[model samples]
Target: MLKFEKVSLTFKTEGREQHVLKDLSYTFETGRITAITGVSGIGKTTILNLAAGLLETSEGSVINTFAKTAYVFQEPRLLPWKTALENVTCVCGDEKKAKFYLDILLPEGSDKYPDELSGGMQQRVSIARAMAYDAELVLLDEALKGLDMQTKDAVVKTLREHLKGRTAIMITHDKSELEFCDTVLEISDAPISELKHVNR
Candidate 1:
């Protein structure tokens, strides 16, 4: 299980401190998919970074027990010089597994570089990379922003199958994506309460 205990996050920009999360506490249960939802710029991505240990919280602690982890950023974040298959294989070092995921997510562009694919195709490659990493905990930040409904359904189905017994936390504005989640969390402002959790 991954946990955030009384965590507070603040960032400094131009000598000014910005408080993103204040005394927040939440738990992402094991073997469940959680969707973090809110209006744009409500510090949703900050929570993911905090959980992933990519950023430090100003106070309290984050507890993670998972051995392997994967993260898919809002941007594709693929190496511009690498092909789609290479991006996934580079992480897991399993060419066959990478090919399997790419076949599901990017069947048409396995050999294509990031620069050679469209924005949506590149995003799919990133998704395939994360899925093929075989991580117990997967963190996705706006990971499905650019795909159409058919592709989104395919990718979501692939993710569901790949994440059967693992944990996934996604930051997204799309409500339809909640169908794949067992829980939903919405950040609430005005007095700054912890995230509102709903079980599906």
Candidate 2:
């Protein structure tokens, strides 16, 4: 399981220190999907970044016992120079798994480059890369923010199948789009709190 114990982050935006997260304490169960949803400025991304170890907490601790992990962002963040296959294969495999995901997520001719793929296709490639990373834990931060309804459903279905038994924590505000999670969490100005859960 992954956990956050009294974790808080304070940053100096202009000059004074500002508190972003406030003593967040959360626990993620093994082989379960947890969705974190909140308003725009309620520090939703901050909590995911803290859980991802991308940012350090100012107080208390953020704990992760899992070994391998992968994170997907709102943007594809793919290397413009690399081919679609090269990006996914950069993890720890040959071309087989990369092509497998391309077959699953991409269109007929999206293996070319970032410049050639559409915005939705690029996001699919990003999801494919995250799947190809072969991690036990996956962090998704508003990954479907800009995709249209059709693209969102397709990618969400594919990603849900990919996360079959792995632990996943997703940061998103679209509650209707979170059918993939068994638990839901929402962050407020007070602290991180659990909003919903399903029996294991």
Best by TM-score: 1
Model 2, position 103, has a per-residue lDDT of 83
Looking at candidate 2, the ten consecutive residues that score lowest on lDDT are 191-200
Q: What's the distance in Å from true for residue 25, model 1?
A: 1.3
Instruction: Write down the worst ten-residue block by lDDT for model 1.
Output: 190-199
Clashing pairs in 1: none
Please list the C-alpha lDDT of all candidates, in the order they appear: 0.87, 0.79
- Which residue runs does candidate 1 get wrong by more than 4 Å? 190-193
Per-residue lDDT tens digits of candidate 2, residues 1-200? 68888877888988987777666677788898888776787677777687778898888898888888888887899999888888888764769988888888876644689889888778888888889887899999887877789878888888889899999989888877677788886555434433334343
lDDT string for model 1 (117-155, tens) is 999999999999998888999999989999988899998
TM-score of 1: 0.95
